[model samples]
Target: MRHLFFALAPDAALRDAIANDAARLHLAWGGRATKPAKLHMTLRFLQGFTDPLPDDVVAAARAAGDAIASVPFAFELDRADRFGRRIGWLGCAVTPRPLQALHDALTESCRAHAVPMREEERFVPHVTILRDPKRAVPSAIAPLRWQVDGFVLMASAEGAYEVLGRWALRA
Candidate 1:
């Protein structure tokens, strides 16, 4: 049993770009930048209401991952804002259709497999780039294009993310 979710991880090049963006955003917005290795866009965060879930739940989540059939897509992150006063984030100017399709497919598949998605109602695609920022007013950044090719299942337990499975989004 492990706390798990599905995420869209950037490739090396994209990670580098995000890291650079994070550095600049942190300087302007004033929060600690998220490490380069830890930058990723979460697709679906599975909730078992606990850190470790049951094996049956894990199996269901895996089966849901097996059901994904989304194609590749491109999206751009061009804005920065705060969830509240503490968290600063970078988000796309517009939600990509293929990205939405992939998320919708994952939601449907997870629902069919009895994986509870308590947070699905408010799905916003964004990446957390800074934490505990000093000043956060909605600001615009230069657009950074991300070519998404696949997504993955991730397990996190002590504030670190670990990839458990990978699934390619194909045409």
Candidate 2:
């Protein structure tokens, strides 16, 4: 069993923009910025499991991905926030309804497959950009608008992740 989750990775152009902002923030506040390659918006975090993921679980995830009828959606980052002393994340002031719908669909799919998931009363969509920043400051940078067209199922191990499947959002 392997650790798995569903996430949305930005295209190269958008990744570059986010990375640039992270670099600037790092210089100003002194923290570890997220690596350019590791930046992503997590849709659903499925906790760790054994090495080979069970076939039923993978099928369920695929079904969930297939159920999503949402088209491409856009979200914009409007502020930088610190969750605590250690975590600095980029917050999206705009909540896209489509994103929520996809998340809900995935959650329901997990229930259908009996896959354990992280329980949360509310889902906050965020992309972490820094860690252990010395200081938190108001972010006045231009909003980073991201156009999300698809999502990927990723397997994580030893602090690294590999994309196992890509699902496009369609009508």
Candidate 3:
């Protein structure tokens, strides 16, 4: 089975800035720092697809992207928090409406394709900083604000998630 999701990737400059912030926060809080490569806020997680995504899935994702008008939104990195048992993440102080809308749209598309989705509670959008097993809490740093313009479709490959495509918001 394949795990899929939609997300926004930070550009090189922003990635560097966030890494620096993570480093400082790690030093202060005595937690392991997150690698810059894995920083992104997920819109939805479509779990348990038996094969590669069909064309309809790509079309639906593209349609969802086309429907969204680009808006200026910024995410500010907040303190560290653990979700449930094994996941650790950097909290962000940002309204989740945009991400939630994307999630709902994608979920609808998956349903339209007769793809079975993992049932879960309401979406609480978050960027993962660490995953699996327990990790120390990173210290609070001055929030890093980032502007988002687009989201990407990603798939699980060889035990790691890889980007499949990126869809930019229409102006």
Candidate 4:
């Protein structure tokens, strides 16, 4: 069974910028800075198949992906914070409406198609920048703004992600 989820990732330029900031933060916080390739904001985590993912499940997920009606949108992350003691992350000071709408649309579409959604705590849109930091007190950072035009369905294993599908947000 593939561990699958939907996520939005930055372009290489923005990724490099984020990685650089993470490196600087790591020097102060003493932790592993996230690799540029692994930086992303998770949208939804889907249930894993008991067996290999069946064709119908894949179809339902694709149908859900295709049904999203959100257009390209932008958001900014202006502060750094930690989750527990391990996950040092960058997060928006406020959740953008378009981001929430997109998440809601995806949820509704998945429900319509009978795709099982993984149970998770309340969504907090964020991107991990460092892991196992000595300490990451809430601090202001130069804003990292993202123009989100598309998202991907990914299969995760062995610390890598494989894109199963990519969908452009509707305009």
Candidate 5:
């Protein structure tokens, strides 16, 4: 059985910057901060399964990822907000079209593979910064830039992620 999802991971330098910024936000908002190593922008979430995914499903994912006709795209994190009383997130003021396209493609691939996904009312792309927040503290953040080059398939175990596959974004 494996729990899997697809995400775009930031490089070490950018991860550091996001960690530092998240730390500052935690200081002000009083929440459980996200661990630096666990930070990633989720593209699509596939729930757990009790058996190995078929080879065709994995191949579909790989081919879908490879077919993303995009160069690297940049995004800016500009605000912090809460999903409720518990989860805190960094919001982007601007999301590139390529990013959205990549997400849509991955989602379509998952559908094609017969992978079941949760029904989310809306898709708001953001990185989680904290959990179990004390209160709602929406704060303006300095615009932080991220250059996304590729996305990866990751398996989850005991609150950590193991990378299963990676596909670069190229046109």
Candidate 6:
């Protein structure tokens, strides 16, 4: 089974800024910095598949992409939050309506193909900084403001993710 999702990754310049902020935060909290390459905001997680994606699933994702048009969004770093014993993340505040609409469309598409959705808590969009064990949350992390022009389908194997396909938002 492969874990799949759509996300927006920071561009090179923004990534560098994020890296610096992450390093500073790590120092303050006595934790290691997040890998520069792994920084992204997951739009959704399509979970629990036993094999490669079915043709219907790809079509559904395409349709969902067609339903979403490009929109500008700004992200702000507010504070630090921890999730049970799993993760410590930097909280983000942003206009969520666009993301919510996109998620709804994608969910509906997946359901139409009879793809059972993952049983998990509702989606709350966030960018993770640290995972497992105790990690310090910096008093301030870099604030990121960028536009999400599209989403990509990604597959994860052996802890590494590869981009399967990217769907540009409809204009």
Candidate whose lDDT is highest: 4
Identify the leading candidate in terms of TM-score: 4
lDDT of 3 by residue, 1-171 (tens): 777777778888878876776665455444455568777777766655667766676566556545555554566766666676456666554555655666777677666655445678877665656545244554465766667777787777665678877766654
Stretches of candidate 6 above 4 Å error?
A: 30-33, 50-63, 70-72, 133-142
Candidate 4, 1-171: lDDT as tens digits = 667778898899888878888888888888888878988888888998654567787788888998887789998878888899989988887888988888778888989989989987777888899999996778988998899999998877667777888999867
RMSD per prediction, one decimal? 1.9, 2.0, 3.4, 1.7, 2.2, 2.9
TM-score of each: 0.91, 0.88, 0.73, 0.92, 0.87, 0.77
How many residue pairs clash in all the candidates, one count each?
A: 0, 4, 0, 0, 0, 0
Tens-place lDDT per residue, model 6, 24-127, is 56565544456888877677677646567666765665555555555555455555556665666665544367777777766776666554466557766666
Clashing pairs in 4: none
In terms of lDDT, the poorest run of 10 residues in model 2 is: 61-70
Instruction: Write the number of the candidate with greater TM-score, choosing between 3 and 6.
Output: 6
* Candidate 3 CA-lDDT value: 0.65
- Report, for every candidate in turn, its global Cα lDDT versus the true structure: 0.82, 0.79, 0.65, 0.85, 0.78, 0.64
Per-residue lDDT tens digits for candidate 5, residues 47-83, read 6765566566556656656555667777887878888
Winner on TM-score (2 vs 5): 2
TM-score for candidate 1, residues paired by index: 0.91
Q: After superposition, how far is residue 107 of candidate 5 from its true place, in Å?
A: 1.2
In candidate 5, list every pair of residues with a backbone clash: none
Which residue segments of model 5 deviate by more than 4 Å? 50-60
